[model samples]
Target: MQAAQTQRKFRGKNKAPKWKKPDDGHVSVMVLPLAITDPADLARIKRLFGSMWSIKRAVQRDARAKVDAYWTAFHEREEHGAKVVRQRLGLNREALERCAYKHLDASGHLKHHVSKALAMHMAAEVWNGVQWHLFADATGKRHGRPKTGRWHDFTRIPGRARSHTTDRKWETFRLVGTLHGHKMAYTDGGQYTVQQPRRMRVPAAPSGPVLTGKTLASGKTGTRKATWWDHTGPLAVVFAGGPDSGRGDLVLPVRIPQQPGQWARVEHFLSNPGRWHKVDLVRRRKASAPGGWVYEAHLMILGPGYTAPAVRERREQAAALDRIGGVDGNVSNVSVASFPASLDPADGAPASTEITLSPEERALLEREAKKRRGRARALERSRRATNTAQYGPSKKQARRAEQRAAKGLKPKAVTVPGGARAARVDGVPKQAFRRDQLSVNYREQRARQAEHAASMAEHHRFRARQVAREIIAAHGPVLVVEDCDIRTWYRLWGKRLSQTTPGLLIAALDRECQAAGGRLVRASTWSTALSQHCLCGERVKKTLRDREHKCIECGLAGKRDLVSATLAAFVRFTDVDDPKAAYLDTTSSRHAQIVFAQGLEEALRESTAPSQTTVRGAGHAAVPRQRRETSAPRTAGRRPRATLDEPRPVRDHAGKPGQRPGCDPQLTLW
Candidate 1:
């Protein structure tokens, strides 16, 4: 099948933007490896490399766990959650719903466009495993989803079909039995083969003679003064004097054809482009003195200009003569001036910077969470199908009468020397009692093995097992948290989401803190999902619906629900927990390391000399800049935000997300 046509443009000489159209000769049709086929061995991939081929075994990363997708999810999900939070805050429902997904559905179209672009571009570096396919519709209009009864496997995941018919079989090579490195017919009537040879591929058009921009008589030819653009596109013809490079002067009118390929011969003859050649100033000595005249360089171009013929037949003849490099149509328009200036680079701007779950965390969420679970369930059904195939009745076994009628067989009892009893299998005679009759069982035995083998082969790969994940996080009161969040009430009870969200911190706890006998907790009013007490936005973990929850009412505070139940739900625990760690670390151990590094910069800055301390502090009474905001004396620990969704983000003078767009100018000033 043909791969997706994904291109990378080389615009002049700059890195092309992710989705912008690029200049020629720099694009590729690409797709995610996993999106195409199951994982393969390194040797096979290397063999496919076969010289000149790129062996980029990349792991496709999902957009959600990366930068933009994470922020988008938060904004979208909380926009939905804000309706209830607004209700609690004494705000009207319509105001909140206006920003909700239901009202802002058009944004989902932009989202789909962006997602399509991202899926086509921005692939990961090779060496990463392929990303699993995860289909998520933000418009999400589906209802009454049904569980499929048939068996499936990873190899059968639906995908945008890769059709081989789309490929342009531009040419064939004699040595390789492949088209673009794939098996295809050779140019000659013989079997093609691959051999060890490397060569650079220069871009070539399939038809007619072409022009390469070069200097004829040393006017200008350094990519700036001359280039090709014709054939129904724009056309410009100009003569140049002096050397082609650096500050060349233009001469009078030059000939350009009204049609494509008419002036190709003249263009080729004039552009004597020798490889690796460059333009440089030539020096000439005066006849009377030894010193050289800088401007006295030789110009091989004939400066004579011709008048245009008024008749069509003569014009056509002139064009034909020009095609023979005769210069018969070098008509005079007007004398040209100096060449134009080169296009310069634009001033660079600071690109967006965002952070979310690390690769490990994201892998667990996108691929490990749902897709892996899907494959597991599919395998479960597959295994059942295999069991049925291996042990279930065949048509021959189902009806003895039918088998007899088909074979027209009435099995005659045979008594050998040992008198062993035997029955014919589908009219195939079995061994009559000994190793002497081994050849008799071959056909029946082969059929049985073939049936069993076909049924069980699907399970001989990385199948999923039960996987569970939890994230536990804390936030400010009147603030919000989100996504696959794991809330712990007791040591064991919890709630988790199917995927990642602002609640990922809470969800993280399932893997990190749950082993200490903590239970995930959730509000009894909700199923630990997006709801009133959950995603609906409330801080009911400390205050109930009746508790007129004011900041300083009684100065009383406590967790309203157990923490364990919160951890279990939002995690989208397809299975109970991930099978990866189980497979890697053995069933008994599940631990990941957290390393600590000392911050020497802050340490050195803090330990600056006492005289330098003036820069650090206004006066002796001034507190350290690194000091935290002091808390007020209270009867209980301060609670998190009332709900996981809150309006607006913290604004700092520096900038949102701590990026100081204005701070860079000061750096140059410094």
Candidate 2:
């Protein structure tokens, strides 16, 4: 509890204090370029970094070997004795660090502090690999210890030495890792002061004081020239052309390689030196720029903290609940039902909107999908060709090749042909070549493919999430949806069709619903029977191919999807006994018009007589009203039965049975 309190005090009220005012939860990156024009210095800077990278890679290789040996022993050991085996084999950070020291000591290329830093770095790498292997084993993604490879490209050099600069006055200020040294400025006519380093001890301080753009009153904060880091360190870096002094307060004596106006930004950083930290001097070669090699100093800037205003919301407040809306997530789209601010629950109706992927969006998706598949297929083919050439063919392939040769034709190259075990070269499998012989081009292609796949998947997910947000905006808090078996559907349909289904879309909708101060309720998949039943509890069975629902029991006929949607709303929000009242309760005026229009069309079609109809009593006069009233009240909306005088059969769908008139029997459904 005491530790917690101390942490709170250091972190302020919301978070760690920032150096800049009105700080947001974002980090701003700034790159400062140093003007180094000397050819010899540029070459030396590149060599320094290159050598550092080489040393780090050497550490990586040694660590990898230790990891491999540990895994080998782990597999050979019993599960109960695994920990003991690890300890005895010394598969830990200390062991790896000692191994790194051995390599560095033999090379004698770096200083003691630098060597210790490199050892710690190697130990950290081994530790990360071991942790990941354990995690993978727990998740069942990997069977045993996981294999690791050397993929490190950049060498990390530590900043801010602790042992040095204790009780220093500059340390009291929030100094961004600045080194105290002589200040160098650009001499006029595109030249700088050149000084050579001597073996003898230097003087206590330089005779002259520092002078730069910060001293000048009128200087722009932004610049128009290129620059880079000229010097970097795991240890202290002394400048060759700097003040050899004691008690010098000046930090970062910079030399401008070009005209004065270009480096105003660099001078600004130096003016308030305490705000920056973890400075790195980075060197790069750019053929496009005029300079053969460029240097840039990269450092993190500190900023001020931000505290959000207090918010107090009452649950019963009319304004808050009034703004919420209802959402309906379906297989291919999302629908929103929004109520007005002044809408009363007893007499109110909701306005609705639907979201769907536009045609252009779908077309672009198709094009990208095609491109991804093509890339995957090309990669697979290349892998197969390379494997076949290196490992030779199997028995089935060899037979085929012989047949082809007999027919005076060239045989196709096939990798791992059927019914043949992998060939062994000196007791090692020929396929082992795959591990070490992967071409650079192949690796590059795989990386590009992985990146593209990630990008496209993210883009699709973002678009879906955005649509979900819009749905919540249109609708108020409560969301009602029917649970679907998406995995089952994917299995029944093809994977491509599954992609069009609302699996991810529904998830996005749920997220947006929560974000908009609402909740989602999932009804059972049994509720989907709405497509086959009327709101009045009458059953109308529909086949998989049916697109329309015609309920002979209650005369509720319309497009199957719309009917299901209306019934779902009714079941959830209104009485099922009286479909008229339920429809009015759940549907908006515009939606009612559409439902009524379809009903009217169905009624008109039903009332019309077929081209030929059989009537049992055509010769007899129409039944009397009194008789009809007494005899079962003549089912309303029913077609007349055949009479004795007119004994002809009624036909539909060009004289076929069970087909309705004025409707195509072969209309596509989904």
Candidate 3:
């Protein structure tokens, strides 16, 4: 039987996986609130959670120690490098798991709090973090080292499975409930006759008792008999042993939403013939709750289904277009330009669109950000007030002391000095500070700040989705964007990038494109300088302040971002996987030239034209041109000299003769 079971497992592993296409299947999460009003039950649940947290902490501690030991051994070796460390340590998932398990077993009494299965799960989580840190270090990527989690950090614990025939089933955590339906009936001889053991319709509402097992009976007053309805019970999340053990199981009644739409959605998902996965117990802090926390169970369901109707329809429409587009993402906005599959630019000018947050949205986000900043500042003040000895003097206080010293007045004591310590290599403060004493107000402020941040993130995500959907709906699914490092943008324009969130929007677009049976192609930034070059095959270098693209070679001028996006539409790559081999298909440049001209003309008109309605955000307004010196007379081979009425360009600050003022001297004309 064991050999047959092993063979069956092998066959199952060899079988083809499902959901090869996005439309083939979908995964949805249903969050059901766990209602535990009884004090004893809540206490038991908290105890179980505490045990899980302890187990996780122990495992993480052990994993960190093991990583440190490996690093020490690697450094002690004759040859020490990423390759040598990998070869000597044999660092992989399996190896990390083995080490984690060894360290877990060595921690006395730590394994007894949870079952072997749960212990292994916690160890696997630790291995995940360790693997991330190790791989990042090996690849020379910036990543923080894995650290032990605190009590508040432990928010979730996953169950093994809903049910399994094998012993591997986590019998501790199980859902107990069933939805009963009315018996099917048919009219026979002008009378209704009930069909035995057949349900007609299940209850639409998740709550309320459901009646079943109706039978036909000959009664004095009626032809049918009434049956008792069974009530759906709570979820049994057991730990270590069964509920009959010393530590009883944590039983919390499931609370489903009563709203019509929500109930309908829940009913639909439950009624679907989808594979039931494991449930996860998640805890969230709520200041208004009884114990400042609320527990919820997340049900994972995977089956055949599509997303929202509107999104699905948009994707369908996008798939039929078969258009190719290019996206030029900036710190404040993103410009998109696309051409149809047929390269006939004569058909029409390429579709061009600009995406940016409107005034209302920006104002709303700014208000929330301001609130969050205030909350953060309040939290910091509370912390410093509560734990005066833990912090040192601020820079302002030090400066004030210096000013006092410069004068004849004595310097006042600002903050209690922390104990001095040895200097470190990482540039951290060489002082031994005491642990902060967190006050209730501080915790409340911190929680408020965190909640505000979460709200802002959700709002940003929603806006990004809307923008992505709009782009896909108009320009088709296939897109090409420059392979520029978003991190560099963050470093350069951190605040602006945070507000606009161009990276998030790009990610959303990529997801939408993939779901619509298309892809987001990344063209090499170095090879195809979309911003630096024009469609006329001329390299035109411009400063950051130069928002207008004016090509002296071809006299093609337009908005810088729009021009770049248009050029990106014609970009081609030798290898799609390798963006470094990107090039422009200049053969069809003439076709796009008309499109560019039309687009530029429209942009110029918009910039120069007076607007009747108020424009918000970055509107197409005229940019001020710098005046330069053009007193020299016109030569035979040279271009026409600027007249007295024409604006003169400013000379270079470096006093270079016969050189353009605004142009960078380091760059050569090509």
Flag the better candidate by lDDT, 2 or 3.
3
For 539-658, candidate 2 gives per-residue lDDT tens digits of 678876786777776565555554554444433434333223222223342343344343323322222111111122111111101111233322653443211111123333447655
Comparison by TM-score, 1 against 3, better one: 3
For model 2, the stretches where C-alpha displacement exceeds 4 angstroms are 1-367, 390-433, 439-441, 477-494, 501-503, 510-670
Mark the regions of model 3 whose C-alpha exceeds 4 Å error after superposition: 1-28, 74-113, 133-146, 162-172, 179-248, 257-260, 272-274, 304-306, 345-349, 357-366, 390-434, 595-600, 603-670
Report residue 33 deviation for candidate 2 (angstroms): 14
Cα lDDT tens digits, model 3, 196-228, are 222212122134443434446733343223211
Winning candidate number (lDDT): 3
Give all TM-scores, in the order shown.
Answer: 0.17, 0.42, 0.68
Candidate 2 C-alpha error for residue 59, in Å: 12
What's the residue-level lDDT of 670 in candidate 1? 3
Sort by lDDT, best first: 3, 2, 1
- Better model by lDDT, 1 or 2? 2
lDDT (CA) per prediction: 0.22, 0.44, 0.60
